[model samples]
Target: MHFTRPRDLVVAGLVALAFVYVAFKFAYGSMPRLPTLAGATLIVLAVIEALLAFSIRARIRQRRVTSALAVVRAVALAKASSMLGALMLGAWLGVLAALLPRVGDLAAATGDVRSALVGTPSAIVLIAAGLWLEYCCRTPEGGDRKHDDHPTG
Candidate 1:
């Protein structure tokens, strides 16, 4: 598969943001208070991906015989994580947009605002880590070559 495109991520995020904003607008009052640290889970994933990127890059640069399957798996993880991050970023932005004006009027909105603030940066970090991992997966020859190391392909 080709590299994940920024345009695709942006479109996905915008679509998710619009959908979430409308839905939350009607249901927010009935919803329970959001956990401030729930979004922070994404940050853990970002850290893992970043570590993987560093390890993979080191292996590639040292001309070690990295496994083709492992590299492909990393690429797949990176692609999925990036897409997830975009959607999450959109969702958090939607929450922020919906709750910001009401923060002064509602007590819960204030806490939810904190949640959104935490989530936005967590999602951004995930996206960055995913992109870095994807970049690290590229071959020394600039990734133009397919998985020539693969036994079957």
Candidate 2:
């Protein structure tokens, strides 16, 4: 599968930002308070992906035969995680934009601001870890190139 492109993530993020911001602008009063640690789950997932990347890279560097299925799964997971991170980042940014101005005037906005603060950084870490995991899935130099052994002379 092809590597995940940054442009795609950016587009996804921008779209989510616009949509979320508009939605929140109108409905924020009706919404409940956001949990301060709402993004903690993303951070946990990022840590797991980082650990997996290190293990996979070590196996590749040692010339150990890593399972093809495992590598494919890792790539898929990386791709999905990165996209999720982008969406979440955009979402948090949207919420922040809507709440930051009101933090001083509204009591609820204050708590939501804290949630956005935690979520934004967590999303960023997840994106980095996902990219790292994808990079680790690559084969080392000269490791799996096809042989040009066909007779043409």
Candidate topping TM-score: 1
27-119: candidate 1 lDDT, tens digit per residue: 988888889998999999999999999999889888884588998999999999999999999999999999899889989999999999999
TM-score of model number 2: 0.90
Model 1's TM-score against the true structure: 0.91
Tens digit of lDDT per residue, candidate 2, span 1-153?
A: 467889989998998888889888889888998999998899999999999999998988897854878988999999999999999999999999988888898899998989999999999999999999988987889443335424244
TM-scores of the models, in the given order?
0.91, 0.90
lDDT, residue 68, model 2: 79
Q: Model 1 misses residue 33 by how many Å? A: 1.6
Q: Distance (Å) between predicted and true CA of 103, model 2?
A: 1.3
Per-residue lDDT for 53 in model 2?
99
